[model samples]
Target: MDGGFVYGGSGLSTIDGKGRCTIPSDLRSTVEASSNGNVVCLARHPDLPCLMGFGTTERDALVTDLKKQWEYAQQRGENFDRQAAGGPLASSLTVIGFEASGRFVVPPMLRFFGKLEEQAFFHGNITNFYIWNPSILLAQETGFEMQKEIAEYFLAEAERKRK
Candidate 1:
C-alpha cells in the first residue's frame, strides 16, 4: 500500500481478436513493482469510455474508501449504494495475470464493454491508466474535439482559476 507507483505515459497497443495484448514495458514495470506478484485489476471505467487498470496499492485504497462509505451509511441509517460500489469492485473486476513477456488477456466481457477492436490507446492518470478503444478515444462525435472553442474555454477556465 505504499504510494510510490507512478502510472504516467501514453501509448498505443494492439489487442488481438482473443483480447490478448502486450503491456508496454515501462507501464508493465510500474505495475509489477506495486502489484502483488504479477496480478493487476481491471474494471470498466465508471464514467469514462475506457477500461480502468489498477495496481494493488490503488485497489486497496479504493476498497478502504468504500468501507468508510459503508460504515457512514450504516451509522446514519442511509441506504448503501451497493450496486455503485460493488458493481465495479466485485462483480465486474477482471483479475488477470501478467506473463513473463508482459502479455495479458483482457477478459472478453471487458473487451466488449470497452468496444476494443484491434487497437487500444493507453493513457496513464497517476494512480491508474485508461485502456481505450482507439476509435472511441478519437471519435469527435463524443464531443472530444480539440479545436479553438474548447481550447480557449479551457484556457479561460485556467486563467480564472489562477486568480
Candidate 2:
C-alpha cells in the first residue's frame, strides 16, 4: 500500500460461491502488518449482528479485556461463570489465513449469521472492519431521517471528548 493509507472507509464486495471475499487492500495491509503472516482471527460480536476480525495482537488484547470484564463481574457479586462466559467467545473465534490473492473465506456458520450471500458490505472501523449483510445494515438505518440522529451523536461525542 502507498504510505498513509487510511483505515476507516466503507466499500462493497461480493462473496464467491465458495464464500470467499477479498479483503480491501488497505484493510488487508493493516491486517497483515499486525498479524504474524496472513492469518486473521474471526469472532462473533457478542451483541451485534455482525462479526469481528482481529489480527494476532488484537486478539490477545481482546482476550485480556474479556478476562478483566469477567473478573470485574465476579467481584460485583454477579454470578458470571468464568468459563461459561468465556467459552462461547473462545469457541466462536477462529483463525483464518488470506489466500495468495488476498481473499479469505468466512466460515459457514458466520456466513449464515451475517446473512451474506452474493454481496457484502465492508465498513472500516479504525482498528478493525465490519463485514455486514447490506440489507441487514440498511435496515438499521433511518434513511435520510438518520441525519439528525447522526449529527446529534457526532456533536455529543465531540463535546464529551472536549471535557
Candidate 3:
C-alpha cells in the first residue's frame, strides 16, 4: 500500500443493538482507497485486547510477509511451522462490507474477541486501525497512553454531545 493510504486519526462510534457501527470518515476513506471498495478485513489483534482492521492491500501484504519469513527460515535450514506462523493472521479473519455511510455489522465472534459493547473507539496505527471497546481501552496499562488519551477525548466528546 502507498504511504498516502495509511490509516490515521481517531474517533468513536456507537454500536447499536444489531452490532452496527460506523467507521470514522478518515479511516473509511483510507480503507476504500486501499481496498478498492468498501470491504474491510477484521481480526483479533495478535497482542492487543482490541480488534485490528485493514483493507485487502494489508491482507495481501501479510501473505507476502509470511512467504518471506518462510523463505528466510528455509535458507537457514530452520523448520518453520507454516500453520503456526499464519494462524493468527488467517484463522479468525472476517471480511465485512460497509455502506456508503460507513456502517457495518460486527460479527459475533469478533465482537466477543474485541470485548466491544456500546461504543467502539477507533485509533489508527498507520497500516491498520484498532477498534477497541472504550472501557477496555481506558483500563489498559503501560504503552497505550496515547491511545487511551484519544479514547478519552472521544468519550468526552460523546458525553458533551449528550448534554
lDDT of each: 0.74, 0.69, 0.91
Residues 80-150, model 3: lDDT tens digits: 98789999868789999999988999998999999999999998999999999989888877788988988
Angstrom error at residue 154, model 2: 23
In model 2, where do residues sit more than 4 Å from their true spots? 1-7, 70-80, 142-163
Arranged by TM-score, best first? 3, 1, 2
Model 3 spans > 4 angstroms off: 1-4
Best prediction by lDDT:
3
User: Candidate 1 residues 20-83, lDDT tens each?
Assistant: 8866666777778778568788898887777888787778887887888999999999989856
Give per-residue lDDT, candidate 2, residue 62. Answer: 64
Superposed on all Cα atoms, the candidates' RMSDs to the truth, in angstroms, are 9.1, 10.1, 1.2
TM-score of 3: 0.96
Backbone clash pairs for candidate 1 read: none
